[model samples]
Each structure stands twice: as C-alpha cells, then as structure tokens.
Target chain A: MAKQDRAIRTRQTILEAAAVVFERQGYQAATITEILKVAGVTKGALYFHFESKEELALGVFDAQEPPEQVPPQPLKLQELVDTGLWFIHRLRTNLLTRAGVRLSMDQQAHTLDRRGPFLRWREMLLSLLDQARENGELLPHVDTSESADLIMGAFTGIQMVSQTLSDYADLEERYISMQRHVLPSLAVPSVLAALDLSPGRTERITAELAAVQD
Target chain B: MAKQDRAIRTRQTILEAAAVVFERQGYQAATITEILKVAGVTKGALYFHFESKEELALGVFDAQEPPEQVPPQPLKLQELVDTGLWFIHRLRTNLLTRAGVRLSMDQQAHTLDRRGPFLRWREMLLSLLDQARENGELLPHVDTSESADLIMGAFTGIQMVSQTLSDYADLEERYISMQRHVLPSLAVPSVLAALDLSPGRTERITAELAAVQD
Candidate 1:
C-alpha cells in the first residue's frame, strides 16, 4: 500500500510537470526531455507511467474531470450556473484545466481524441439541463441537447477570446456576460429571474465548498 | 505595370501555398521550404513577398479583408445578417480564410499578431451595430460594442464546433442558428420579425453578389 501510494504521487508529479510544459509550449513543441527536467524525474521513471507524449497529453486532458462534489442547490438552473461559474474560476487558476482545453482545441497537434473533453462537457451539461427540465426550469421550446451544444460552443468561444484578449483575467466577467445573454433564451422567465448568474459567484462557491470540506 | 502584376501574382501564389501547408500541418509544423515547393517558386521570390514564416502567417491573416462591396439594403439589420452569411460562404470555400483562423487560434505557434483578425472582426461588427442603432433597429438598451463582442465570440464558437463536429459541412446551418438566437436580444421585436436568418441565406446572397458583380 505504501509503495502504491508513492507510485501515485510520482505519477501525479509527472502529470503536473507535463501540463505546465504542454500549456506553455503546446503539444507539438513540448518535449519529453523538457517534461523530465520540470518533473525532476529520471527518463525511466517517466516512461514507467507514460510511454509517450500523447499519453502524457491524454493524462493532462483527463485530469480536468468535473469537480467531484457539487454543493446541493435549491434549483437545478442555479446549479447549472454554478457549474459554469465554477469552471470559469477553475479555468482561470488551474493549469491542468487550461492545458486540457488548449490541447483539445489544438486539434491538428496530435492523434489523441481531441473531442473527448467537448463530448464530456456536453454530456455533463445535458444531464444538468435534463434535471432543470424535470424541475420545470426550462422554457417550453427549449431543447436540452441543443442548448447544451450552444452553451458548450459559446463557452469554448468566449474562453478562446478571453485567452487571446486577456489571458483569461477577464474570463469570469466574460463568462457571466455570456450567461446573462444566453440563459434568458433557455430558462423560463420565472427561473431566469430567480437564478444568480453573477461574476465572483464561483469564488463564493469555492469558499463555500472549501468550508464544507473543512 | 506588367512587372507589378507578375509580382502581385507571385505573392498570391506563395500565400495560397502557405495557406494550404498551414491548414494541413498548422503553424508550427508547416515549413517555408514546403510552401516554396508547393508554390513552385524560388526562395528569392518567396522572400521578396514575405520576409519570414511569421510574416507569411500575417499575410494570410490580412487576406481575410471584408468584401469591398456590399449590396445596399433598406435595413442595416438585414445588412448585418448578410455580412455574416457572406462570410460563411467565403469561409466554406476559401483556404486563406481557413488558414488565417487556424493560425490565429494556434496562440503558441508563432509570434505574429493573433488578435488582428478578431479585433478587425469586432470592429466591423461594431460599425454594423452602430449603423443598426442609427437606423433604430437595435433595442433601446443595446450596447453596440458589447453586442459586437458577443456576436464575434459566439460566431467563433459556433464555427469551431461546426468544424469539429462536421468539418464545416453544417457551418451555414449552425451560423444561422447562432444568429437567430443572438439577434433577437440585440434587435427590436419588429426588426427581428422582419429579418431573414435562414440557413440558405448564404447561397442566395452568394448568387445575388455574383449577379451584381457580373
């Protein structure tokens, strides 16, 4: 068990190192030797976990799993907003998330499944929207799947613009603005009125989650 | 004048060659030598037109100038929709535009000004929105700059998604859907009702433009 724990730690260290390199230099330009230098690990140790750079990129991409715990909310629509807000916050601060998104967008760089993250995000949003629909939150004309597609596409676009314009410093504000513009078309009038789609909601939610974890 | 025309043709040939290579391999992996080979031009000829690969990328970016001529419209809102529709048609058939957008999104690949195309697009949209406002086509609360940002961001996102999902086969449809969703918020109800945001609008506009040019 102790040996297994140590192996896990080493693997995590390697993944983080690769994420930093991939995020900085992109997949085609990043080298295993650079990752080794950043990780402070022997080539043997690095190869023991990830056989190739593609595997390392996949590892980084997979690291961006949806948060394991979501604080319960009174309304599913609020939860949806929280989900986006929380991700914007994470995308701003988390190198892994940023690298994952960057790799996914760099479709010509690798043979790995570039669409995985997008599909996963779509599924997650669809599930949430399904719940919102069940809760009578969606407009009568709203199609959850289409809305999920629009939300994912719009979010990806906004993030790209933010990255180009401000390196994501303005991500929270832009994401909130996006939600403000888009949600009115998706949610019923009453639900849209009740939902809190404000900037800094992610920070407050993060604090709440941290307090709960404590 | 003959010498100038030859120079112009040579430059266009190199730009097309570079666009093809960049579209295939992206910015980092694409090589000037490969571009020269494809263009069937001497290195001196290529250098006479573009100094370096970065300059070549910028040249491709600059090639995406808005159409010089727009058919006059009674409503600026219709003109705005026609602008996007015309772009969708060009983006479908134009390799230079494709290469420009690809390179712009490949943030780490080159030192070229990646934001030039986006900022230009935003400016063009802002001007159109300003015209729409002057014509009283916009909502009372509509901010032209913000609406321009939203339109640009949303269009980028929808295009990316369409590229990923269908290799742009459905781009026209997706772009039309995006405008349908977004324009209602910016335009007044009467104008929105009057606007034709249909999927086949691009083909019709293309035919009309060709007829006018002829």
Candidate 2:
C-alpha cells in the first residue's frame, strides 16, 4: 500500500477494533491488548495510530455525525427536517444506536467539563437551528440555542427512554409524535404551518394519532 | 430498630451512599463497593438490603418527587398532569440525569434487551396519560400509551442533547417551549376553555411561559 493509503487503513483498523472492545467491555474495563487482538494489529501499530486510549476513544467518537447537519438546500424543508428526524427515528430502531450509546458512555469517563466532540455536535446543531430560525423557519420567541438543545436533547432522551421501555416498541410513531406535537414549541405557528408538511401528511397522521387517544 | 424503622434506615443508608457515588463518578463508574464504603456497610449488608444494582438504582431515582405526589390533595386534575410534566422538567435541571444515563447504559449491556428505572418511569407516565385520556383531559386523538412514550422519549433526548451542546446553558427554556407550544396539539378547543387553570399557580406560570416564546 502507498504510505498515505497504509496510514488510512491502519487508522480504520484501530477504530473498528476499538469500537468492538468498547462495546464489549466498556471504556474503563477494555484494555489495549484486547483492541489489538480485535483489530489484528500489533501494539506498535496501535501506538503509531493513537498515543493513548483516550485518543483512540476520541477517534471512535469522531465517526458519528447525525444526518441532520447535511447541507440545508436543494430539498423540500420537510426533507431537511425529516432527514434529521428520520435518522433519530432509525437511531431508536437500529443497533447502531445501541453501539453508539455504549461507546459514548465508555468514553465519557475521561471526558472533560467542556470542549470535545460532544460540544462540536452542539455547535453544528445550533448553527443549523439559527439558520432555520433567521430564515423565518422558527418562532420569533423560540430561543435558538436552547431550542436547538431541546430538539437534540429530545432525540437522545427518546432512545434512552426506549431502551428502558419494552422491546419491539415503535420508534417511528414516537418520532412522528415529537415532530407533530412536541417540536411545535420551538417553531412559530407560521413556521409550523409552513414546513414542508402537506395538509395531507399532517391530516392523515394526526387523524391516526387522534384515533389512538379516542 | 423496629421492622419498619430498620427498613427505613437501610433504605436511607443505601440511597445516601448512592447519591454520593452517583454525583461524583457518574452512574456507570460507580460500583457497589463504592456505595458500600460510603454507606459504611459490608458486602453482605449491601446485598441483603437490595437484591441488585438495578433495584438500588431505581429505588433512589426519585429525589425530586414533587409537592403533589407528597402533598395534601383534593387531587385536582391539572395538578396530576402538571406534576407528571414537572417530573420530566425537573429531570432536565436535575444533576442526577447524567449519572442516571450512564447507569442505564451499564444496565443495558448486561442483557440483549431489558427494562430500567427510566423505562418504569415511562410506564408510570403512560399510566398517568391513560388517566388523562379517560378523564377527557387530553385531546380525543392522542393515544395515551404512544403519547406517553413520545413525551418520555423527547424528554430523554433533550437532556443528552443539552449536555452535548453547552455548559451552564439555558435548559429551563426547553421546558417552557414544550409547555407553551408543543403541548397545544393534544388539547381540544373545548377542553382548553374548560381548563379552569388556577390563577395562583397555573396562571403565573402560564404568563411566564408565554413571555419566553414572545
């Protein structure tokens, strides 16, 4: 392999291995020896890639980027919001969320009070939320940063809450409910009305949602 | 100690130790050994008092049960719903949410699928929602079980999302947004009128919430 290609391959190997070990034993319990075993890499190779366990953990953390941050253009507003919304819906339904969550907690041990990949994700979300708000896509009263935090927070809460609830429960229904019912608070009534939702999608879903309570 | 007194003391000691460890190390890192040491108890004593870590964790979960759950009550309908809403609101500001999350993740790894304290909280919420539906407090269309799950899920999502976003950020506004805008979908226009909200408690809070959105 060329030198640059070899470096990229090795980096991928270490992260893939670390993800496995972190998933299995958690961050505190997982040893470097085990990661190397999983990755099928030598300790020398591991050291060349990462100086410490924390660095490796961070590398793994960097692998995640929620789909909501995709460039906010060339699509219906619903697609933009729904794409982000849809990822979280799948996040609840998928195994990746479980792995992602396990790995997140594992690395959280060494995490600091501020400044990290976690915060970077926040900045990305707020930037998008602010852009949407300024574009008259959100309510005048909705505090951009806090509302962004709330929207993001609700996604995490739903996944964790799902794990605690019954297995084989519906995730998409929860997402629909949030987008339709819960998220309106962060929106202007005009924005809520203006989002890429057709009267048909809203009417059909809300009708079904309405029937459940009745 | 009398039987009741002994039970009370045992619960007290276990929970007290739990609070310390949970607050300091976060939940996943805290072990029975640590809680025992803080409680000045033996392994035997610890195991005798609580069947498992899950039981102990959930047992101490509610440090913030509101005045209503603890209150002198004629048991107004609004209070019950408000209390449920407030429990979720308290969780955002609650320092223990982080520890609870880490602990929940740790608990999840022990089984391919399982229920945790947070899940039980969801169940409790569903129970409340069911009552609300029966009482005609919610809009006719809202499915109590699904709505409960949806609200619970969003609440969970918001907390982690906030932590990931900022330190000392304005989390309280998230709750206000939920209350003001997001909650309206479940209301029947008639019920909204019927809601003779207490000016003393509900009105003052309502005005404050309206201001946040404005």
Candidate 3:
C-alpha cells in the first residue's frame, strides 16, 4: 500500500512539472529531460509512468477538461447566456485556477494534440445546445448548433485576445452586453420579460460575488 | 536616390526572410543566421537593416499590420455585421492569405513586445462602434465600448476556430444567422426591416460566391 501511494504521488509530481514546463516553454520547445528534472524523477521513472512525451501531454490536457455544461434552469435565454458567461468569468478570475483557461487558448497550452479535449468539449456543448433547443428554450429562429459554435468560438477568441493583451480582462463585460442584445432576439417575449437585467440585477450579483471575497 | 532604393529593397528582402523564419520555426526557435541565409544577405547587411534580432522581429510584425481600415460606405447595423463576417469568410477561403490569419494568432506574433500593428485596429473599430451608437443603430442600453469589444472578440474567436477546423469555414452563413438574432433587439425597427437576410438572399450570395472561383 505504501509503495502504491508513493507511485501515485510521483505521477502527480510529474504532471505538475509537465504543466509548468509546457506553460513556460510551450509544447514544441519543451524537452522531456527538463520535465523530468523539474519533477525530480528519474528518466526511468517517467518512462515507466508515461511512455512518450505525447502521452504525458495528453495526460495534462485531460487534467484540465472544461467544466460540465451548466444544466438548464427556467430563465430567459439571455440569462442562460449570462449565467454561462458568468461561470467562465468566475473560472478565469479565480486565483486557484486562472491558468486553467489558458490551457485552452494560449499557445503555451498547444504542446499537446488538441483534437481530443477540444472535441470532447464541443460534443458536450453541442448536446447541451440541442437539449436546450428541443426544450423550446431557444427562440424559434435561432440555430443552436451555429450558436454553440459562435459562443465557443468567441469564447476562445476573447480568451486569446486577453492572453495577448492582459489589459482586456474586462472583455467579459463586453460579451455580457452582446449577449443581452442577441439573446433577446432569439428568446420568446416571455423569456425576455422574465430576465431582470437592470443595473439592480448587476448590483445583486456584485454583492453575491463580493461575498466570496478572497 | 538609386542607391537608396537598392538599400530599401535589400531591407525589405531581409524583413520578408525574417517573417518566413519566424512563421516556420517560431520566434525564439528561429535564429538570426537562418534569416540571413534566407535573405541571401551578409551579416553586415542584416545589421545595417535591423540593429538586432529583436528589431528584426518588430520589422516582421509591422509587416502584418492590416491595410488601413477603409471607411466603409455607411450601412445599417446588420449590413455592417455582414461586412465584418464576410471579411472573416474571405480570410478563410482566400488563397493568397488563407494561412495568414493563423499566423496572426500564434505565439510568434508576440516576439517583439506586446503591442503590434494590430493595436491600430482597436481604435478604428472603437470609432465605428461609437458612430453606430450615436446614430441610434443599437439598443439604448448598449454600451458602445463593450459592444465593439464584443464584436472584435467574437471575430477573433471565429477566425481562430475556423483555422483549426476546416469544417467551420461555413462560418459566414452562421455569422449571418447569428447577426439575425443579435441585431433585431439592437437596431431600430426601420433599420432592422431594411436589411435582407432571407433564405433567398443566402442562395443569391452563394451564387455570387461561386462565380469568384479561385
């Protein structure tokens, strides 16, 4: 049992080291030797745990899988978007996992083959979108597949821009406002009316946010 | 004058070589020696043109500055969005610059300091957004600054995804569909009514697109 625990601990150490090295040097530039050195593991130990660099990278990528799609609640389409946007905002701003989002957009995170993780997120999102649309939650005219692509695409793009210009962290507010405009058009009048999107709603969320002060 | 022209041509040749090197091997990985070799210029010529490797990278980045934004003919908000989405579609399909958008998003673009030629675009877009808001083209509640950032962020996002997944190149249609949802709430009813986004309109555009093969 002690030996098994030690082996598990070593695996975690290697993954942590790999994430840092990948973030710092990017995928193409990083070397296994350096990753091994940082992890304080012997080359034999790393090879035992992961046969190749691709295997290690895939492991790291798997660790940062995107959060599950937010389950639908009875709200305006705009509110759904706002709540999703808010979820990402919190994820990106959280001190414990700010680097989490970077793993998706920053080239530093491009060290691994992205087809797997990216596609998984895409699949999950597409399913959620179809579910939302079928539930009559989507406006009659809004195409959920395309909307999913746009939302995910823009999310990645906005995040990429933030990576390039750190000053654009507040770019999320822009997304929120855009959602307010766009979501209303797709939402039935009833859903649109249900959303309390005034400045007071912002105040309430702000207070809720503040309650979780670091 | 003749000697100066020759020198200018030589300088441009060196910069072009630098771009090729940076794009292929990335910024830190591509060396000055490789650039010189590609330029077929001596070290002295390279030094004369660009003082150092960093300066050479800046030269390459400056070359990427999009041709100045043409003051597009005044159009409705939907039309304005169509113009923007069409640009992204063209970037995806255009043979001359198909890969160029991909280069813009990559890490090498950040080689020479943070702000590159793309900074000019933000200011230009901000002005457009201000104009749209002033003309009552957007919802009264919309913040122009946030709205502009939203459009810009989404543009970057769509382009990023399209580059990686060729299946996403159909973004133009989806972009139009997306605008359909986004615009009605934002634009005045008259402005919204004037825009043609019918299914027939899409078939017509597709026909026109087919004519421009290559």
Candidate 4:
C-alpha cells in the first residue's frame, strides 16, 4: 500500500511538471528532457506512466477537467453561470487547467486528439441548457442545442481574446461581459435578473462548496 | 516590366503554395521543401522572397485580409454582418484566408505575430459598431466596445466549432445562427427587424459587391 501510494504521487508529480513545461513551451516545443528535469523523475518512471509524449499530453488533457463538479443550483441558469464562472476561475488560478487548455488549442499538436475538451464542454452546456429550458428559464425561441454551441464558442473566443489581451487577468470581467451580452438572447427576463453572475461569484461559490464539503 | 511581372507572379505563386501547404499540414509540420515542391520554384527564388518559414507565414497572414472592403449598407449593422458574412464566405472558399485564419489561431506559432488579424478585426468591427450606435441602430444601453468584443469572440468561437464539427461545410448556417442569437442584444427592435441576416446572405452580398466594382 505504501509503495502504491508513492507510485501514484510520483505519477502526479510528473504530470504537474509536464503541464508546466507544456504551458510555457507549447506542446511541439516541449520536450521530455525538460519535463523530466522539471519533474526530477527518472526516464524509466516517466515512461512507465506514459508511453510517449502524446500519451503524456493526453494525461494532461484529462487532468484539466475539474475533479469535482460544480454543486447544482435550484435555478439551472445560475448553475449554468456557476459552471462558466468555475471554469473561468480554473483558467485564472489553475496551472493544470491552463496547460491543458493550451495543449487543446495548440495547432502544432498534431499527434494528440484535441476534440475531447470541446466536445465535453458542449455536452455539459447542452445538458444544463436543456434543464434551464425545462425549468422555464429560457426564452420561447431558445434552442438548447444552438445555445449550447453559442455559449461554448463565445466562452472559447472570449478566453482566447482575454489571454491575448491580458493573459486572462480580465477573464472574469470578460465572462461577466459575455453573460451580459449573450444571456439576454437565451434567458427570460426573470431568470436573467435572478442569476448571480457577478465578478466575485466564483470565489463565493467556491467558499460555499468548500464549506459544504467540510 | 516583363521581368518585374514575372517576379510578382512567382511571389504570388509561392505565397499561394505556402498557404496550401500550411493549411494542409499546419505551421510546424509544414516545411519549406514541401512548399517549394508545390510552388515548383528554385531554392534561390524561395529564399529571395521569404528568408524563412516564419516570414512565409507572415506573408500568408498579411494575405488573409480581404483586399476590397464590403460595399457599405444603409445600416452599419448590415455592413457589420456583411463583413462577417464575407469573411465566412472567404473561409469557406479561399485557401489563403483559411490558412491565415488557421495560423492566427495556431498556438505553436511562436515566431509569428498572430494578434494582427484579431486586432484588425476588432478595429473594423468597432468602427462599424460605433457608426451603428450613432445611427441609433443599437439599443440605448448597448456599449459598442463591449458589443464589439462579444461579436468578435462569438464569431471566432462559432467558426472554430463549425470548423471542428464540419470542416466549415456548415459555417454559413452557423454564422446565421450566431447572428440570430447575438444581434438582438445589441440592435434595436426596429433595426433587428430591418436587418438581413438570412442564410445565403453572403453569396448575395458578394455578388452585389462584385457588380458594383465592375
């Protein structure tokens, strides 16, 4: 049991190091030597966990998905906002998520499949939208699937623009701006008014979730 | 004069070939040897024009901008849509624009300045949006700058999703869907009613612009 625990810890250390190198140097420019140096792990250990660079990237990509889901809300729209905010929070604060996102968007990463994150996001959004619609939070013409695509695209584009403009320092503000501009077309007036998409919402939600878990 | 004309033609040929290769193989995987083979030009000729792959990518990036502006519309909002639709049209049909767009979004392209297209696009959209607001086509509360960011982000995101899902075969419909979902938040009810954002709008607009030029 002790040896198994150590092995898991070692694997995690390597993944974290890979994320750092991949984020800084990009997937194509990132190298095993650099990752191994940063990780302080033997090549044998690295290879034991991940067969190749592609496998390591896949591991990093999988690590980007938040381990815990956002706690559900009574108003599905608020839940939707929470999900977006939480993702923004992750992008802002988490290196693993940022590196995973960078790798997913890297055009030079030809060997690794990049579609997983986008598809997963769209699915998650689509499910939430369907719930929002059933709860009477959506406007009459709001197609949940179309709105899913719109939200996914808008979120991605805003993040890219924010990254370019401010290195994601302004991502929360951008998210609020996105919600302000986009939600009007998808949600009812009452739902939109009730939604808490404020800049500090993520921090508050994270604290609430932490308190609940504790 | 003939010698200069040939030189110009050769340069154009190399750029076009580079665009094709870059689009097919992405920026990193794409090689000058492949471009040279496609262009059927000597190493001297290629070197004379573009000193390196990065310079060649820059050339392709500059070439992505539409040479002729969209013919103005009565409503600046219409003009804005026309610009977007025209870009969508180019993305669907033109390899140079597609390659450049791909390169602009390429994360591994460290040597190239990818911000030009995004900044230029925002500038163009911002100008049109400012005009639309001046003409009272916008909602009283709409901030043109925020709307510009929203529009840019949404447009980029939609294009990426569409490209991922369909390789851009369904981009026109996706563009129309985006306009439908997004326009209401920015434009006044009367302006929204008057706007022409239907499918096949790009084809009609392109024909009108071509006829006007003729």
Count backbone clashes in candidate 1.
Answer: 0
- Top lDDT prediction, candidate number: 4
Model 2 — interface RMS deviation?
3.7
Give the 10-residue window scoring lowest on summed lDDT in candidate 2 chain B. Answer: B66-75
Better of 3 and 4 by TM-score: 4
Cα misplacement distance, residue B116 of candidate 1 (Å): 0.6
C-alpha positional error of residue A120 in candidate 4 after TM-score superposition, expressed in Å: 0.8
Model 2 vs truth, CA RMSD: 8.2
Could you report the DockQ of all the candidates, in the order they appear? 0.60, 0.39, 0.51, 0.54
For residue B67, give model 2's deviation from the true position in Å: 8.5
Best prediction by TM-score: 1
Best by DockQ: 1
Candidate 1 scores a chain A TM-score of 0.93
List runs of model 3 lying over 4 Å from the truth.
A1-7, A69-72, A75-112, A171-175, A193-214, B1-11, B69-71, B76-104, B108-111, B167-181, B193-214
Ranking by DockQ: 1, 4, 3, 2
Candidate 4 per-residue lDDT, tens place, A116-168, comes to 88888888888889998899999998888888877887788887777776778
Cα lDDT of candidate 3 equals 0.62
Better of 1 and 2 by TM-score: 1
lDDT of 2 by residue, B1-214 (tens): 6998987887778776886686566555668888988888877877887877666677555553332342222223344445544454445455554345545544324532335455665676676666667667677777777766666676555545554454325444454454444556665666555543332443444455546557
lDDT of 2 at A181: 70
**On lDDT, who's better, 2 or 3?**
3
Residue B199, candidate 1: how far off, in angstroms?
1.5
